[model samples]
Target: MPEAIHTLRVALPPEAVWDFVKDMNKWAPMLTGYQKHTIVTETKSLWTLKGDVGILSRTVELEVNITEWAGPDRVRFTLTGLNEAVSGEGQFEIRAIAVAGSAAAAAAASAPVAAKAELSWWQKLVERFARWFLGRQGGGQAALPAAPRAAVTAGSELAFTLMMEAGGPTAPLVNAMLEPALIPATEDLAQRIVTHLEKQHGLG
Candidate 1:
């Protein structure tokens, strides 16, 4: 089985995050390689995704069933492959956290004054190279906003946990191929959700 867990800090209340995540329709398309989805009922849906598995690319259909919906806290769901032998489960969790916005702002305000120095030639060259490499890795995606600069506020921590495994005669081989894709897919979905919500709030 391949499992991935990603957590992000959002400068918003847990209730706000829950309001967005409670509706799957809003974030389902944020999944990497998402094609389409159909809602069958409140607790069930079907999804189509096209993605690369090792050197081969294919489309898979999955049946998603919500097992629990704990508002302002968590959403747990199970996945069953409709057109293939695969099954998985995942969840989204959000919790409140204290954000020291003023303290951080104060630190940032003093950073330039305390470190007004020029970088050496090699340092400048390395910095430029690092930026270029990071830009390429980002794929030009919209960057998330910086943390809020308001007074101490109530923030939320969002986590997405996923576990997937393939079945059938070729289970081992398929799992090997699937393992490499899980983390990237999980990260893409989770970060996109945070980006969307953060942009909507835009306190930063």
Candidate 2:
């Protein structure tokens, strides 16, 4: 099996990060190659990912399950191909760099980021989908609070990793090819989380 592990540090606190990842739908569409996902239940979801299969673009169906939720720290998941011969395990790990808020009140906050450029079409689509799937309330989505307490601040590290293997004679070639794609996906995951948290906390 080949593994891809990537990490990113964001200004948001662990609590805020945890809040976002715990609800898979909030970030699922942000996934690279993401097409759509349907929650079969709370822990299981059917996902369709669009990516290149050799030289041809293809959509692959995957059945994913959330195996564990170590809140404010990690989420473990396992997935298998529904239409192809592949299987993988992945996890999102979160750790606080500094805890500033009282334990009773959970400590973490982010500074306001400068306004960003207009989003790409897919960005707009994903945002719209997330808002619709999670619902929207005026300028902000009806997900988390508009802003966390200004008095709190906690730095956090968010990481993602996956180990996967393709079955068959071309498995090695496929794995080698996938190596490059995972890095970009991981970066996308990090940026997506950071941007969403900042927006959630009214930081823009």
Candidate 3:
């Protein structure tokens, strides 16, 4: 089977970007295929996704294992289908944008302070669970965290890659079916997440 990769660049600091991407509990629901996801353990999770193959859409369950967990930078995981005929690996990468001595860089470097929000009920619930289980709460108060001031450099980019193998050999069909919904959803979610970040931080 072939792999399908999608990349999206968000204007945020590398660390901030990493923080958002590494936290599955916070961002997994943003994915187009996601129905629901639950953390099973420190490095394991169960995900329910809607398999929207142009011809049909059905819910599927997957067990995911964290294969790589590096700090403020990257995440890699392999997923096994629990009730579907697909399996694959995915990864997210973040990096700091190098700013040259330009007016834009200077302005960005000195951008006004970003605002923060109080935690929402759901966020509080997640925080409470984390506190009980992991002994600590992640960022966010009543709302989500704000994007870092440092924007991705002019040429810097953030990329996401998803590779899946199916029992059958209809790779092209599968890719075609998933791409339309997947791409738009990914972009939409990314925008929403960023908007939420801005609202939380008083940027917007």
Candidate 4:
């Protein structure tokens, strides 16, 4: 199985993130290759995505079922491929930022420095794909706010974790192709959610 987990500090409270994430419709389009989604019931939906694997792109249909919905904390879901042999599970977790005087808080503040380490080849490829997909060639026009209007002291943290696996004869090749894109996909969704919240709250 291939899994990707991305966590980032958001300048909003846990409840705020929950308010948005509770409704999949709000963030569904934020996905990297989102085409559309249909809600079948409170806990079931169908998603259509046009994903790029290496140099080839194809449309994928997935059945998403909510496994758990814990307010202001987490939402867990399982994915079943309708038109392909794939399955996975994912979750979104929101929590208060590390306590101010705790070692965790200090480490949280230093996370950016640690993240500045070198990137792997696949990571570099993912970056290029993202830039191209977003239609920005070398820092094009700015769209979002340059900076948040105010600093957030008691903010929250958001984490998204996803795991996927392909089955059958071609599973090996399909999984290999999917490996590079998973991390970026998770990251893009988490960042977009945070950005949208910041903008809505007038922080951006």
Candidate 5:
């Protein structure tokens, strides 16, 4: 099956990023479709998500398992639908860029960063399409505006990306049908999540 991917970089130390990503209890709700989630263990979780697909609105439930948990650098997980028809895996990777050193040194010696996420194939596709459309529109949708990049500090930057794949092969079509409602909804959710995180860390 095709996979959709989204990435976001934040201006935070690797440890800080890892801490936020490692704990699903804190960040899962940041997702646009997020409804509720429960941690089954350090490596397992259950999720409920609500969103629209074309003209159809739905609430989906799924299970997620952490396959890799390399702190301050990367996280990987697989999502399985509990009452839906979706299954997929995704990962978050953080790379640091520095301003004072040579490109090679900066790349090799930048600050540590971390990311965490849980999503299904269908959800990923919808998110990818929304982003593509938003980028083409130049960011003026009232509900879903373009995501703004922020400087972590004087020379560091933070960015966030989200992609969700629908439950089946027809997800792209479904997403397209729901574009009118989804775009604004997505933008609103994205902005809120960013705002919440920044406030949480005193970066807002």
Candidate 6:
């Protein structure tokens, strides 16, 4: 499948970054053409996003399923276009930033481990378990993966990716026609996320 991947360095601990991003409600609006999103259930969501297909601008609802919930590290999900019949998958990965010897050793003292993130923390934990069990039941071994959560002594790096495919005979044409919009959206993912997170700290 065709995929778009973008990565950026975030000036916070991996745990802090994961706590913020694990909740879709907090991060969905960060999409380039995002309009709105609703969490229908713990693992399911309905998202309305906008983009232009050539000269015709389109808005569509997407059915999203969280396939993997690796806390403070990675998350993977798949989406289906409810009205248009397109399907795709995406992932968010966080890796610890590397630094010099003393700088790396001192980095752990800078950020709070949990930081009073009580509201959505439990939801993510529940996601980790639910996705695991569900993935196991319905032949989901490939779909649901347990991402390792290791301690990060330095800042973190965030990466986002998305893959889209038209679910019908016209997939090629659809992908070709939608290439312009898809490219920008995919490229914008990382910058938007970084800017959003940085703004929370009053940074540029």
- Index of the highest-TM-score prediction: 1
What tens-digit string does per-residue lDDT give for candidate 1 at 1-204? 777776676667899999999998899889998999999999999999986678888899999999999999999999999887889999998987555455343223211111001345577677567656765775421122324546656767778888888999998999888877877787778778877886677543
Q: Model 2, range 29-147, lDDT digits (tens) per residue? A: 88989999999998899999985555666688999999997898999999899998878889998887542343322212222111111345577677667767775443332332224
Q: What is the TM-score (0 to 1) of candidate 2? A: 0.70
- The window of 10 residues in a row where model 4 has the poorest summed lDDT is 109-118
TM-score of each: 0.75, 0.70, 0.62, 0.74, 0.57, 0.70
Residue 29 alpha-carbon offset, candidate 3, angstroms: 2.0
Report lDDT per candidate.
0.74, 0.68, 0.58, 0.73, 0.53, 0.67
CA RMSD per model (angstroms): 11.4, 13.1, 15.3, 10.6, 10.7, 13.1
How do the residues 1-204 of candidate 3 rate in per-residue lDDT, one tens digit apiece? Answer: 334443433345667666666777777777777889999998999999886667798788999999999867788899898986777887776555443233344333323111101245577677567545543243211121223464434322345656666556776677666555454444445555554444454444
Best by lDDT: 1
Task: Show model 1 residue runs off by greater than 4 Å.
Answer: 102-150
Residue pairs with clashing backbones, model 6: none
Give lDDT for model 5: 0.53
Q: State which candidate, 1 or 2, has the greater TM-score.
A: 1
The deviation in Å at residue 35 for candidate 5 is 1.8
Error of 5 at 24 (Å): 0.7
Q: Candidate 2: where is the Cα deviation over 4 Å? A: 99-152
Task: After the best TM-score superposition of candidate 3, give how far the Cα of residue 79 lies from its true spot, in angstroms.
Answer: 1.6
Return the TM-score for candidate 1, rounded to 2 decimals. Answer: 0.75
Evaluated at residue 201, the lDDT of candidate 4 is: 74
